[model samples]
Target: MTDNRVYLFDTTLRDGQQTRGVDFTPADKIAIARALDEIGIDYVEGGWPGANPTDDRFFSEPPALKRAKLVAFGMTRRPGRSAENDPGLAGVLGSKAGAACLVGKTWDFHVDVALEIDRDENVQMIRDSMKLAAKRGFEPMFDCEHFFDGYKANPDYALSCVKAAYESGARWVVLCDTNGGALPHEVSEIVAEVVKVVPGDHVGIHTHNDTENAVANTLAAVRAGARQVQGTINGLGERCGNANIVTLTAILGLKMGYETGVGDKGMKQLKKLSRMLDDRLNRAPNPHAAFVGDAAFAHKGGLHVSAVQKDPKTYEHIDPELVGNQRYILVSDQAGRSNILARFTEIGVEIDPKHPKIQRLVEDVKEKEFLGYSYDTAEASFELLARRTVENVPDYFSIERFRVMDERRFNARGQMVIESEATATVEVAGQRLHEVAVGNGPVNALDLAIRKALSTAYPSIDGVKLMDYKVRILPPPPNSDGTDAVTRVMIESAGPDGTMWRTVGVSANIIDASIMALSDSLTYCLLKSGTEAKVDA
Candidate 1:
């Protein structure tokens, strides 16, 4: 039997930076590189060493990768320049990376038109760069930019470019779909032909999502015997994007049954890895992304929920848990008993399926949804509501009343500044406590006041921090004015152990909605931490 092993190379630090809105600082590069290494990526391409200040700083003190080889990216020696003197080639060779991937043009059109150089000179540039990298004690890889289109136009020249790299000690010869217009069939056919000259183990695939076929094209190459895959996390890149390595990781492990550096343990962190990238970029995650998306395993229809309850395979292609994603039974006016029961199991709530109160819980959720509360994105709030309805949920702390005051004033330095202060009256355990605090904003002030009121009683609150806050205004009820419209607030909090949960609130007043969500966030954190509540008689 064939070993069927494939190498996973990540370029999120390099190619991903080309994304229009993405600009990775040195610190961002370090953190992302470490994350890629932790997830068992075979190679982490840091960036071009001397291209920009950020890239220079990143390579100056590259993150120590435990498993993956740190790769430096640059171009081959420019036309008419010696491999030793080309500043671009020197940049890559000077880096402390274990490996180097130097991109060179393979398309004859690019050689004649773009570089305005002889075809033979272009091939020699690739060969000399690879040989120098090998002599310098670095594993060399050649990125044959526009190889797919080059092959279609001039197969012999394209093959010669990669063959020169392989013969000159390149460990990997990557064929790039620079135009990203090639179909899956074209990629498969071209890759199969290229493997005839260079061994499959030495062949790699890099694709763009111009036609939305980047992932498909990559898979085609793999089927055609390419052994290395290069891509960015979440498909971040110039133009449309690169192939999404997150989706590829899942498909390669669970569906294709190929061996990769990422083991079963690393496979389980796929969703976390995907979301971590989005969080670092301060962008919302794509809920409909394949395999690891939030909506990937969510079942909304009653019939689908009922069928999935009997056996998940009825609708799901693979177990969501395989990729660290759980099945979400979304309940609304369209929900059934199956949805409620599945949700209970998901939250670890042990409730009888036939409990008389289950119907009431469903009705209550529907009412809340109609009143502008969306549980789909706020499962922590839904879980709390479910528990409070049928279970004896303790009142850990109650906010009797709260007030926030905001003012603009001049500081001692004569600089104008805005300040907010909040006061909270709360009852916890057996005592009544009143706390006041100041913060940068009204919500921040309220949060500080609440923490002050609960810190002595529950020190665990200190370990939890609000990660995100979002608000949405719903349409006014009936003939009510737009000013009287209800607002929904959702807060995402991360605990000490890195567990994140989201809670939601809704009210006509934004402050009231924020307080409700904030309180639920604290309550959920305490419950998950298993802190005992003290209530005096």
Candidate 2:
């Protein structure tokens, strides 16, 4: 049984793709629209069909709109043009949209300057577009452009514009903040009066983030009985952006007790959706973005971690599962053993609270952080440290001798010479295989040197690869001297079996940090593989 009910309208393909440096092909639009339907959006605004060939293609692609109704967004009909003959309206019909939304000039200023039409003609266009769309067998959404400002200027005229949408057979009359400059107080007041005459069920809020109050204003409107909230994920769009669906859905479901998602898939999908979109757009996700952000559930500081240990609600407002997010307690200079234990335990590795190894782990982390190595944003690194501290016999094959010669001399063509050699000897059952490989980097040269030399003798060792590497010099405190810095490295790698994990390394020497992370990344992958194999068998 569900208690809360509020409609979710996603405009990611239509408006979110309008973000600068962002463009989605028809296939991309189809993928996102299907994802929206999977996530249970009440409406998926595909795009302005008549406006773009990509949107036109999306309609013809036979999309699997599982749970969401498809909508086409466009401007109202031209003032003098017949609505049926308008290219915009024909696009809506051709696209086969179950619903169509037409935004018309509502403010007197837009009527005069933007639409380049008289007030009377603008109203006529609104009526023609909606009535035409509805008569053509589509649910119509009327967007009263700048309707809030229009109301303040001429209350009677603004109401008349809304009345036009109603009489035009619009199923949902959406009040659009085209310029995104309306205040919450104004939105609530205007929406309150409009709802009195507009039939609350047929009203929706279409807002933008220009004033950075999209989230706040959306809350105000929902409080004022607006049924549908229009938004995009991550608040992405042209200029400022539209309201964020992630934020809106979270607030409505968790804070306002409204039913936004239908199942337990909500919380996990939220984080995944945010990351998937980030990957698709090739944009680094905003860590501070609410609900699905990386830091939304990330915990640092000994104090926050301590309280979270007792009651997560002390620092976390909503259960992370509510948004498909999970708590990540990261260990840093500010961390205590509790933080380490919490993180390790969550990942299924437990360290004894009274273990003598904890002292070494604490000292190692502090020394690295004191130099400039932070494990906060680098949890993959910290896990290696935790594993090393507790595991007595880690199968870590130490590096022997390595050298890098950048023969970049002004006198002659530069020759890069990197040679490293390493050894890894493992005992399985009753047999022992000792292998060695050499590679290019002081570390890589050493790793390959050991593996290359060893693989000839050991048939069990087959697959290997190094995938990703990241390095950052830890920042000094406000009053601390900046003379010295330690580089923290994070490396992600994968072996032949398709296993992948990140490892962290901290060293005063940048090369050593890189080596540490690489070595740990390999070991973590191997160790997890070994553990899983044993369990499966």
Candidate 3:
């Protein structure tokens, strides 16, 4: 590898799994491993095999990766045990991974206090374990846990620990900011000193994010001569988190002029990969995340929007598309004509900036926003509003009436069960259709009834599925009843081809709001599928 080339080691399956409430099933680990391989990661740390049954099964039939080297992670051989006899070391060897990473105590405090072992014995452990792994035909790497803090306290001992691993035939000696409290300058200083004893090509950096400086520290280490960086996707890890490899990769490739496994093409998939992880975890992506967030490239202020529209470089440091994100011109009270024109174009509507209707639309949007509509987060709803003004939206269906009932009753087993039932009367294609359904909740029942009523007239409705539903209660008006607050519902729907979209609705009643959003979601799906065009014709 060239001096400018940096290796990306992803530990999302191992360290990221250490996060609170995060437990990846064997299937989830397989999926994430494939995704990491697809993105050209250098090394993917599969978890400790013998420590957990799930990880053991995962390694038993590891996913066939084309690019990334599957690595098994474990601690050094136990004190007073031979590397060959230690079960932990045996587990790492039996994992059948292409590589093995063994973490050992580099900090004297951990050596004396945590492990209660003599300093020389810890060095022997690192040497023995790494030598054993290499002899077994696996590329071995050593994680010098708490190297920075240890170096600060006992520089000679920390350097000896790293030296021991390198001399033991380890391919990489990674310095770790295990406590995650080191400043960038401190990292640079320590790494520079270590490279004097060990070549930079043989060194790597692993950092945590307790002080929110993991990325900075990792970069600092690189500048000081480390060639590899270890981190997790979206910064998911134990405590505060690990360095976010997504952000680190972008900065390394785009800004710092370093070559990573994820080249320009792979960089475009970063956002998609980040979102895929969040999807598997059933969590929403952070809108403000560095490179791939929803709001990363969004411009809202009038001056900022105008500047970005004229020349994106005026406001944005880089093209959003370079990272699989797009620039968004948000419409709000702060929006100007530039914002309106840019937003219209983004939603595939071609309206002249000078058109009289553009001003009308701007004013209308502002008034509706004052009435509790947020166009920034609900682009699907904004598109519907814009399309309605420019052309007639196909009137696919209309609800004449709907009724929902909820009841709690004890069953023969003496268990109390709550049931909800909904009935819907819908007018579709000049025909009245009635349908009823029962569900676990009122929203689910209403959604089922509506879909049942319309599926016959529009068979394509059967392909649409509601993926997510979120409701927020807005503050009540000053003179209104505080107990009855307006609700804003955002529904995420997906078509059979996996095309997803979000629609929003607001009303005093939660059910009414949910229904409105659900209808809009289905309407948008039909329109996008061109079914609405066929219906109109």
TM-score of each: 0.90, 0.85, 0.95
Across residues 414-512, which tens digit of lDDT does each residue of candidate 1 receive? Answer: 999999999999899888899999999999999999999899889999999999999998998897777889999999999988888999999999999
- Which regions in candidate 3 have their CA more than 4 angstroms from the true location? 478-484, 532-537
Q: Rank the candidates by lDDT, best first.
A: 1, 3, 2
Q: RMSD (Cα, Å) of candidate 3?
A: 2.0
Number of the predicted model whose lDDT against the real structure is largest: 1
lDDT of 3 by residue, 1-537 (tens): 789989999999999999999999999999999998998899999899898998999999999999999999998999999999998889889887999999999999989999998889999999999999999999999999999999999999999999999999999999999999999999999999999999998999999999999999999999999999999999999999999999999999999999899977889999999999998998889999998999999999989988887899998999999999988888777777888888778778876667888888888888877766787877788888888877678888887888899999999999999999999988787778899999999989999999987786678889888888888889987888898678889888888998778888889889988888988887887777777533321
lDDT for position 438 in model 2: 52
Candidate 1 deviates by what RMSD?
2.9
The total number of steric clashes, by the backbone 3 Å criterion, in model 3 comes to 0
- Candidate 1, residue 254: Cα displacement in angstroms equals 2.0
The segments of candidate 1 whose C-alpha lies over 4 angstroms from its true place after superposition are 1-3, 25-31, 57-67, 279-284, 429-434, 456-459, 478-481, 529-537
Clash count (model 2, backbone only): 18
> Per-model C-alpha lDDT, please?
0.92, 0.76, 0.91
Candidate 3 lDDT for residue 501: 81
